[model samples]
Target: METMRVIDKIRQLIPPLSPGYHKGQAGRVCVIGGSDEYTGAPYFSSFSALKLGADMAFVVCQPTAAVAIKSYTPGIN
Candidate 1:
């Protein structure tokens, strides 16, 4: 694919920034997964959303995994 064309197509998919919009109006995402045997899955999903410009990322994981996830970053709530 033509790089510029791909870039333009992606840009077109993004909503225009407007003062009328409030926080999280552009994007909000949640990733829910994790367990004693899979503690990193939820964190990875939540982090991917944040890296992609989501206004908020939430991880809904088992209580046992919460501490590890929280310690990994302050970005996930």
Candidate 2:
């Protein structure tokens, strides 16, 4: 059995970006995980989504985790 090339698969999965696109229009993602001692997970997940061109990314977590996430980036709110 033959499989598609990695580049081809990537091209199919990720859409191309248009010029002058506004925020929250490309894609929106929400990561629901985090705790006082586990704040890193949501941070990484939200950041990865943003890096992938997601227009908006949010992380829902406990109050303590929320503070840590915000410390990492004000944009995560």
Best by TM-score: 2
Tens-place lDDT digits, model 1, residues 2-71: 9999999999998776878777886888788887778788888878877777777777888988888888
lDDT by residue for model 2 (3-67), tens: 55876887888878888888887899999999999999889998999898998898889987888
Which residue ranges in model 2 land beyond 4 Å of their true spot? 1-4, 74-76
What C-alpha lDDT, on a 0 to 100 scale, does residue 30 get in candidate 1?
Answer: 75
Count: clashes, candidate 1: 0
Q: Which residue pairs in candidate 1 have backbone atoms (N, alpha carbon, C) closer than 3 angstroms, thus clashing?
A: none
lDDT of 2: 0.85
